[model samples]
Target: MSDLRRRALAGGKTVSRKARSKPESGLSSGNHTPNGSPGNSRAGSRANSRPGSRYASEDEYASESENDDIMTISTNSVSGEDDPGNTWAERLQDRVAELQDRKRSSVQGREATLGAYNHLLKHHFAQRQLDKSVAELMPILLRGIRNGSSDEERLRTLQAFTLTVLTCSPETIFEQALPILKAACQDADAENVKVEAIYALCIAVSYGGGSSTAAEETLDFFLEIIESDGQSVGAPDSGAVVTAALQAWAFVASHMEDLTVQSEAAIEAFIEQLDSSDPDVQTSAGVNIALLFEAAREYEEETGESFDMQYNQHRIMTRMAEIVRDSSKSVSKKGRRHLRSNFSSIVTSLERGKGPGYSTAGRAGPNPHTGGPRTDEQGEFREFGYRERIRIYNQFLLINTWSLHSRAELLKTLLGGGFGIHYLENPIVKDILGSADVEYIPNAKSRK
Candidate 1:
């Protein structure tokens, strides 16, 4: 195995002491399960542990009807299911049985697991279905991660577990799944498993009705992973883990309404990553820095108060510009090109104080006298910021804010082909976006 992969697999399983302490900003305890809280035990009902604003408010139905909701959802037909016995729950149950049969070949078990996940992505699961199934499903899935025959099987199992989190009600799984997922983050046997676990935590906290304080604590935990670069945590020097941590941190940070509390330290940490040997790490850091700037701008618009975090914006912009034109030979030509493209967007975002993509107002051509490159009205290089498109039913949802953009990217990575389907049908997704389908269109049209 490659060195990077080895380190990733050897990631630390312990949460840092610093992460466990209450955040300095009066935020809630960052621990996955607060001390003495009902979420303290695996068997504890997470859905009832805390009063949540989003997921809890929506889960007001009677407990007796939980099974009814599950049956109703499980009985619904998914596209291309011709067999009467091939309902989602039955297929899932069959796969689980196949997986549990010790006599089955490893290949058969892996395929069975994948088949179950494929079925999951085909339809959204209601809260009742999740509540009824999670008790049985989570343990088996966790076992797959620990005992699966190959790294591929373990990774697929992790992916399936994340899909289960996303497709079902977040509250149903949040309390029960968070600690186990954190244990996966500390997995010393598989680096990819650790990476996938971090992503899973991001999804759970974001969709599972975690408070802004919980989100802040989650971001802090990821930042520790990123800043340590896997060494302090007893993991190897793996850029993949750092990159995953960085991206996951940004994914959760993007959802926060205010970043001022974390801005100065977070931006400084991200700026240091601009010097990373891994190009992926560099770009992820750059994008996150831009996201901070975007958050600051949004905060200013909302509160009309200047953000207190102070840093040399000029220096950061200069470093991004240098990255845009870097010609170092140690980096591959493709890597260099990607850095240029990513940094160009970062530079644009910093220069314009907005997310990347060209200006909505028609751009004026290059300087008439200097005959320079294409520039916006502000006379800066017209660099395009990365944008993701999601089709919700008939309308195309444009993700433009750094927060929404981060969520879209993370969802796409987690859900793969099912992102569009979830974006269309999942309430958790809609809640995260806050009517983004309705909010972003006019802005996109204006930017056209």
Candidate 2:
């Protein structure tokens, strides 16, 4: 392992611009209970505790425990001078150029390069900045990923590339970044790099505004990885790579309007995945099952036709219930708890004939202004369909569809502390979340 990554995983200090703070990542599942939102109760407490629960990537440092440490860089690190008036674009251009000129052969120089990139990621970049700097950033980022002196540098560069695709004009960097990401996904020597590469590719396809055909093709690639049990990527069936592939597949699939054509075989695959011993792999597979059911429900409603999933619904729920109540000695307390909470929500969604978050206690229905699932005699709870809510600034962006929810979850994990800033300033982010139901709170404190 690279020295930097080894330090990070061992909970030692590594180059980070600021001491990481636990931002109130509004990514918490908002299932409403009788008392209040699910965040207040034990069953739903996991949502508040780990904001980046679904991310299998190495960048999820913020979700680590309080004891985990990172070395901080002072303001002068970027350029020996303090220039408060410089925009992010100017600073980024200067830093990227500095990194390019630095010798990777020198240990100090390489660490400095990683710190510079980390500092950029800590702050939000406005659309103006991204537009001005993306052209200059892409080639350097590509080189850092493919030929950095260490794995840590490559991983950080890949993360930066991900944020770029999410916030910048896709046309500017998509073509350049996609090919490199594809090659990285198949890299046999670096499993962490390959897992991260798979996720980065999914983000590129999702927000790139590519055609539906492109999205399907990318999803097919991920499915092959899962079906092959990571043999496609040279990893084991229960490895993190397969878990990442499963999540990535669901993240992309959530965006499609109708997945009926692929539902039966895809669902069967998911069911088989549930038998895997890895808790992460099991949870990911379970969520995909719920996602498929959610998609099937919507399709049937829209087309006024029967969307037969061809699987036994009762049998699936029984398996999900077993995981919820599981008390096996093999699984740790934390793992059991996570499994219970997630599957409990899934079970509720299935029983209620709603989507993933519906079964949780404290959720309100989709924002009333944005039309949602049909309202009926069951009151607002019944109206609570599948969607996730993101609390950013004073606005609540309600991602009222499973597809948008999947995209939002992944973006939240990638952006971390910068998510609210990007949502407020980046037009590309605005476009991806454009259809979300918006709720404005008059005087709420910002939750970035």
Candidate 3:
């Protein structure tokens, strides 16, 4: 048994020695030998290396080491450029001081400083610079909003911040700048600040933040201003506030899918302003209403459903006609002419069966005694006589009246013969009688 054990040990030792003496292939094996070959030693060194392979002589390690050395040197050099003992807060204070000093220099110098600050703000918000600008500007803007700075300065800062917020990617701006915008909207005291804050909120929303919510808040703020008793005071520039409210509404309307749903009360207030004594306010209201109607019409056309099927088209038409007929208002003539023109188009389209049909085209026919309807009371009739109808047809022809395109076919029947120019001017006709054409008359030779 002792002899067998010795032989087994000797065989194992022989196998290990042969394995060690064999030439290394420079490929990984379970065991390695020292002084094998330069290639094998290098391979063994790589295999034994750490996860980061710090001992590996690759170019990437060399470059990384060089970069680390450079960064170390830069840190060591810049460490004391500002006071080494200064806290991060103190550094920020010093930097802000420097910025202010630059801002207080000559106008050109101040503008340049602002421009550089704006550029840095943009880069920080964009996540390109990723420095203190994003953190620092927020407090500056908040201070401006809280303290009510000059309009120009407030406007400048707000515009710069707004541009930064607007131009940045959605995620970054939402996370970093959205709260700032909301705070500005809530805290701003200066009208220009408020205006710019609203505008910035609008831009942020456009870029995909809490646009709908921001719009609602802004609209609510304006509505409050518009409804307050202080609006009646002459000192606060109520007109400017009203104008800003209107502008915000316009922006909200453009961005919102169901503006009427969200702003029904606001819309009603605007509609009420249509009857204002001030022409400018009234005109603005009218234009906004028209825009709303136009948008509703386009929506209906696109979706194949009316916004208000039960809406009274006739009421609008009648009101417009009454305005034209009043003859008391300064816009009476213009209102009447527009009403007539629009009514004519409506009649034609309706007769063609393309729209809601209502024909008022031939309401003003000619008279037998006057040729055309008298501009007096007697010519107002619910119906017409045969000669009067013929004269009406003539007047319709002169006006190139629509909805009466078939009038050409009825000409001979209406006139009892082909219409002669003499029919245009008869002696018995009170109107349309001057410059009678003798050549076209049957009695022309006898009269001559």
Candidate 4:
């Protein structure tokens, strides 16, 4: 064994005379203390000079020592020393510039350099380690999506960019990420790339300011994707694509006022997806439809004009009923609740009196009693049909009449007079009267 190894193994004890005689060896240079410090040389020499130190009994040393002499060398070795003053940022910038220069030289080099850039992007995103320089790198990352040699590289870069954007400050992502997503959405070769880009775009929209613009652009791009020849073989099965589009629609539906300015074709494309085989797509489509209805309803209430429902109310009601009666326990439970909760509005609209032959015009034919002229005696009696009176009574029963005394009185008058509840022995009326403890006479004269 070499002198240094031998002395290091000696557990800080005095060096033997035989070891000291080997001055030419690296360990005898006086700078070879086990702790790697030259200051410990005198301590080692004095211990060695003692009479029995060199030949000390192993048990004596063991009994005196509290610990084994284990050298603690740092694992981090500095090789071919570089300037310590250079910051990590400077080094990274130099490395990035060098790779860019190499990429400018040859196509093969460019591909290799791009691969490294993508790898760094993924690492930074996964590590969530963003710095000021990363903002500068954002354009470079965007360029990779545009110039990537393979679809896989583009997809990976796009995904990394999206996560980075989502994790980044809103202002930074808005400024750096939105344009790349928009460009990627337009490129036909970058189908998978579109998925992440759209997601990032949706995130950008959620950040406010140019959000509506981003939403419009994203919607247009998605409509193009769904209507593209590539999507003709089968519907767009891309979940990311569907989710992004749906989220954007929800954002726009809630925020944007100029729906007419949005492309009609986009709305139609979404409507078409309502029939998609994919349940997620169908659910999103259904939500969008509901949002549209809510928006329309608000518009009508604000302006007092009808907005086209654009869907068959009867068909929807029938489907809801089927869902309510579905054999699947889960379906029946949820569906029945939804139906019972929503059916009154639908039934009221359908039961609202219309012109003669109105209901029959579009279907099997109008109900004989729906719009027919009243008999002279019936008109004199001021009576309503059994179904019509029951519907009105149900409507009144659901109102919060207890808190609104005037509303309660108005309801009582309407039910007793116009609805002819004064003469009817209706179970609904009986329940309402029993709950309120108010006597209702079917034939009672109006008091007011």
Candidate 5:
């Protein structure tokens, strides 16, 4: 074993050599129950003492049928049938039973316990034990993750228990795990540790951290990690770390409610990424930027902040329009298609609610400093739905129309100059270059 440990270190893999004896109760192996009863484990005892732990003292539902929403989603389909007799809770108890059967806390023994806890959480999640009663299981899982002696064990335990954290209420889970995950994302830890922590934080916030403030806090850390490599460009570790940070950003965007300044900053950063020399960085940035657009919500900033309605909408639109024009001539068809599709969705939706300083063609709008939904006759916040929907449809037409005009402008340049003028009199060419109109670019034919 000592030789194996040395060999593992030579290979640069994380290793552990901690030795532990089996407990008198055989808790190391999952075969034996903690209190000689399936659900009556040590964690269960601890749970009974914690506040708001439904799993400890209450069987909230009269039966599985009463578990209505929680029991609706099942893993039975994925796992296949033959186990209609057993519930998810029963299967989790079985894994815990195996955990108790382990005789030692060696690397192998620790792995066995991790596997057991992972399966337990999997079943628990599929069951959607909606009581938010994590107390019955949280401590034991936390112990495994925290007590992990090797980097390898820590990573595995972190992933598993952080998953268990999802079964917790967002507020509770964020309070307990956010600080630890954030600390781990810092420079003091190994690269792998930081990456795993970011991964876990992604899942936690995406699933349970409803607090936009938490999302805001988490977003700041990741953006720093991503921007750190600005000087080196394509340096190795930087690329991987930046990709992970982008993933975290996308997850947070999916869960956040308001992202006025944050979203714009992210948009600009991703736009910068579009210019990266590295193809991988470009690809990641492109996809994530699109995903960000798809996930974007209305801008909500309570604090007095500057937001120019025209600048915000027009800047993004112009960039996207440029990308579209480039795509028409560029070899990379995929990048063009992706930008066009996501851009259409965003450009159309962004202008629906015109806050202050919006040039909506004499249309009435809310105060720009306090842009929000308009209230109805009864004095409740309600949208002018008909007007808004009409505006959205018009915005779509405006974007496409401008794109056509751009095409016309480019065509005029081609037809009016050089040897290209020889084909100008062709029938199809003449029809497209009609004597200029209110919508065509340049306002008049440049045949001269």
Candidate 6:
């Protein structure tokens, strides 16, 4: 609700949702379908036009008619003799003709993105007019990707350009697309645009280009976002944007190889999520912490030395325990207790000293440490496999296995949910639940 954050989301303008219709966002489901790529068609002719199509987020804004930001409407109601006129068709033709007539190198910014979209329209609506190649079209996109005035403009430009890049050679993308995406991720704009930028950055990684510096910068950027205690998370639309951010952070974390100081930073950020008022945020944070653990484990296995996740593991676990243990008006007992139970399950299933081979989704295989059925009837898409799963979980088999016993109070804190099995059939920590001496730590400080 802070003025600054509001302005960021609104692109410095204030408009009621019903009054102002946003344009379509550019997050593509697969490879983008810019004008010339395989299976490519004019984006204008296909996207969101179809019912039941997986459209962009509902917040998408832009249109030749409704979105003032994306479209430049003519002042005159009637079309002049020389001008194509005020009709949408004529406007579309005029824009495309203008782009084709203008020098490509000069195109930049929001205008440039509009031009690219117009180009998609030209190719899709009228192939006889089609003469541009993917190679020729890319520079305009790169320019637009770097040039948009608003977050919406940048995101749309990136979305329109996605299929083209996906279809092109990866090496070219490594050189051209990578920088554009990195800049977007680092740029100052709305949180939604930043979320898109992070997504584009992660998408760029799949292309196999960029320097180590770019990689480090991408990794560091998300970690910074993670550690940032931005007040924007409270906004209604903010969750959708933050969810994109968390997902992007997960993508970057899983792909990056080395374990650096930012790993600790990322872990700290996830730990902070434990205190979020939102249950979804809490759940995502809990899930992603497991990701960092697996990544750290991967780095150590690849190299002989320890990756030094040693910084906050104990303290973080202590906090998780405290959240679950504390029964106060301040904390959501159900959510916190459930999260703690999940953490304990992860601890129980993972080998004491091994790194996690599986991902958060358990794409590798069935988790060995957690021997019970990984399948859930409600988990419509959850798929657990074999050794790939086995190999993946190995890294986290022994995660946070340090002696909490030395701090008996912390051990007791973890026990608060020992028999709390809302998440699974097993006790949160079976071994601890069976112990004779452990008692719930009373009156732990409230999670901030």
Instruction: Write model 6 residue lDDT over 240-349, tens digit each, in one string.
Output: 34444555566445445565756667777777777765544554565567666666666678787687775556666666566556534455665445455455533432
Local accuracy of candidate 4 as per-residue lDDT tens digits, 158-256: 644543443343354565556666676656354445654555465455442356666677556555655442252122465435644554455434545
Most TM-score-accurate candidate: 2
Write candidate 3's Cα lDDT for 3-82 as tens digits. 22221110111123322322211111343322122112210101111111111111111111232233223323122233
> What range of 10 consecutive residues in model 5 has the weakest lDDT sum?
44-53
Compute the lDDT of residue 432 as modeled in candidate 1: 69
What is the C-alpha local distance difference test score of candidate 2? 0.59
- Please give the clash total of every predicted structure, in order: 6, 8, 0, 6, 13, 34
Provide TM-scores for the models: 0.68, 0.73, 0.39, 0.39, 0.46, 0.45
Please rank every candidate by TM-score, starting with the best.
2, 1, 5, 6, 4, 3
| Residue 56 alpha-carbon offset, candidate 6, angstroms | 28
Instruction: Return the clash pairs for model 2, or none.
Output: 31-362, 31-363, 32-361, 32-362, 32-363, 33-361, 33-362, 254-403
lDDT, candidate 6, residue 400? 25
lDDT of 4: 0.38
lDDT of 5 by residue, 1-448 (tens): 3321121001111211111012111123333322232111211101001011011111121112111112112222112133334343544444344333334345544554553344344333322442323453444445554555666556556656554544444345656666666655563244555555666776666554536677787787676666664222222345545655665565565445455557666766777765544333444454445444433322323444444322354665576567656656653665455445434443443455321111223324454445853444323433332111101111111112221222232222211121122223333333332332222223433433
Which residue runs of candidate 5 sit more than 4 Å off their true CA positions? 1-88, 97-103, 116-133, 187-193, 205-210, 230-236, 277-284, 287-297, 300-306, 309-448
At residue 44, what lDDT does model 6 achieve? 26
Ranked by lDDT, top first: 2, 1, 5, 6, 4, 3
**Model 1 C-alpha lDDT per residue in residues 123-219, reported as the tens digit of each score:** 4444444444555565667677666666556666676677766666446566666677777677646677677777778877877657777788888
